[model samples]
Target: MNGNVEVVVVGGGYGGVTAANRLARRDGVSVTLVNPRPEFVSRIRLHQLVTGSDDAVEGFGEVLGGDVRLVVDTATRIDAAGRRVSLAGGGTLSYDYLVYAVGSGAADPGVPGVPGAAEFAHWVSDFEGAGRLRSALDTASASASVTVVGSGPTGLETAAELAEAGREVTLVCGRVLGPSLHARVRRPVARRLAELGVTVLEGAGARVTEVTRDAVQLDDGRSLPSAVTVWTAGFRVPDLAARSGLRTDADGRLLTDTTPTSVDDERIVAAGDAAVMPDHPFRMSCQAAVQLGPAAADTIRRRIAGKTPAPVRMFFAGQSLSLGRNEGVTQFSYPNDKVNALSISGRTGAGVKEIACRFTLNKLVSGARKASSRGSHGDSGNRLETPQPEHPTTPHGTRRSA
Candidate 1:
């Protein structure tokens, strides 16, 4: 171990991995990544995993850069003042800088009367949850009625997949599909859902009051008899930032400026869903994750090299939606959230989405390979040499959103 290592990254998701890999390319900085899991879950494809369309889960070894050291442990607490991180076991990791890339998770709707919801409701956000949902679907009868709550992308994707599988699907959305999308874009989505045999229920403020074994009751006195209910309403950040006394947003997301550094501590940085970048408070998506990861790494590099960091830029070429197999909708949008005139749907849109997914995977793989090559060249000049204690102590009570 060479000591003088400059940065430590928490989490091993899209953003964390990308940032760590980029930082590793710098000659004078060592990057250490801490994550609970050994593999990276392709969260974007989780819907396909749940629908039994795809079973391959990509591993981190295939994507992590060599120069970045992978620590297989959960970050239990962040000691900002001391520039140290306490792991789950009993040791401590000290660093000159830290990046919080812990992601977000589905927000539990505090609806009353929903029985066994926490235990029964299926979500497509993570790998384990997707596996559970897939198993339930396979066991369900052909005539079973599956109710999907939330009209966002995840909900729409889930409904489309089930419908395509020849199952009865009811999409219960408080609003229409792509509520953020323009009316023109929304019309095509509705038509596609209808064509897929998915019953779209809109304006039905179906505030789930309770989730029973066989039905979901809405605030409007209607009971939707469903064999399964999937929730995809909203997301919440991890509570680690708030518990560590760092400034955060109302929903517990770490508050950062355009540079993506923690509001309270310049030594700490954040990205992905866990960060609330004031200048770009866009919705949490893989798109934002991909951009912010590299941006965060660049900022850390600039700071370490005593250079001024550049402002973060927000851009949106378009938004794409997948509707099972080779059918989807792609809507172009401006930087200011304006819906542009270009819209593509059906097979062409699906093709575009497929290309996008492949592009992301390719970038990740390429970055990891570069990182690994750098590590094998006997390069620890930028790497920290401090030997982390074997039995690391995990900080208690840090809540994670996702």
Candidate 2:
């Protein structure tokens, strides 16, 4: 753990960016972030991107630490034995430690076994997918019918955004709308969607059995005309970890211990949606990514100093849903992430959702600027504004949280 430490952070998403910034605050640490795109994508705004609300992209220079190197390339493989990362653009970078944060994206459309789902349905999960969806919408008739499959946060937001844009929309909820929210919150959300003129098909027999170029078939023998079908059913992580022969859960998430270190290699750690904390697994949302980012960095910083890495501590507050630009819903949950009776809706909820999105970007910028604070004040205790080990808790599972 000697002269200087070379840390290569794969994936420039929320977790990788925050981890790079925090790690760069310490002296004698060279942080290089490898990502396929040069700009930082604000994934939460992807739904907005589809409806021409927000482009959902920012320059890495605005959010990344000035000292951190940004490599615009995809990671092909991780050579753990050689401590090297092979890039898709050619050449390999050597690293003393690796941070795996290659976040998740839309799951395979073929997974549901619905015909034409993969070829016909559009997605809004990733940057390129959102752009493709936008292009498809732009070319399609404005009066054309739009159908959104799945009722997660993404589906709800996308359907609402499209409906507000004056698109004839139908929401085919696979099972229930806002399945993770408390019954109290779900009621308000359904009301808002109804007000937006969203045709919500819930309860049994609402699941889509087939997706065609012009319509969708339901399990209950119903055919809905869909000029443009959007599929946001599920998400899957990149196969880079599995491809590298690293230990991963069945979902292809990198398996880590309490300290967030890879069970196979001490020099490797994980964060974001790609990481699975078996003991305290949480959802795949920005909430978890921002917190886990600094914790992963803390682990690396401790190891570099020849100290034991501390265990990661995390919790959840609630779920935020933006039903178009004027209305929304916020469902409060216990620290354990169980939906409680507490809830908020209408304009107040919209304000909360907007503030949360703004705060996410601000948090990254603040973390990047912390390097100067380190020089002025020296490494202070818990410099990163990440969640601390105050009250460690776990969540039920993944659910929609915008």
Q: Write the per-residue lDDT of candidate 1 for residues 1-402, one digit (tens) a residue.
A: 234556889988888989998888878787888877767778878888877787636766667775666666777789899888887655677788898999877766443336667666888777777788888888989899999988888888888888988889988887566676777888888988999999887775656767777788777988898998888888876788888888888888999989988889988878699989766687788888888889899888888777888877767777887888869988888875567767899999899878888888899988877776754755322221223465343323322111
- Specify the highest-lDDT model's number: 2
lDDT of 2 by residue, 107-216 (tens): 88888688899989999999999999999999999999999999999999999999999999999997788788887788999999999999999999999888999999
| TM-score of each candidate structure, all chains considered together | 0.90, 0.92
Candidate 2, residue 90: how far the Cα is off, in Å:
1.2
Off by over 4 Å in 1: 1-3, 111-116, 377-390, 393-402
Q: On a 0 to 100 scale, what is the lDDT of residue 89 in model 2? A: 54
RMSD of 1: 4.8
Tell me how far the alpha carbon of residue 120 in candidate 1 is from the true structure, in angstroms, after superposition. 3.1
CA lDDT of each prediction against the hidden true structure: 0.78, 0.86
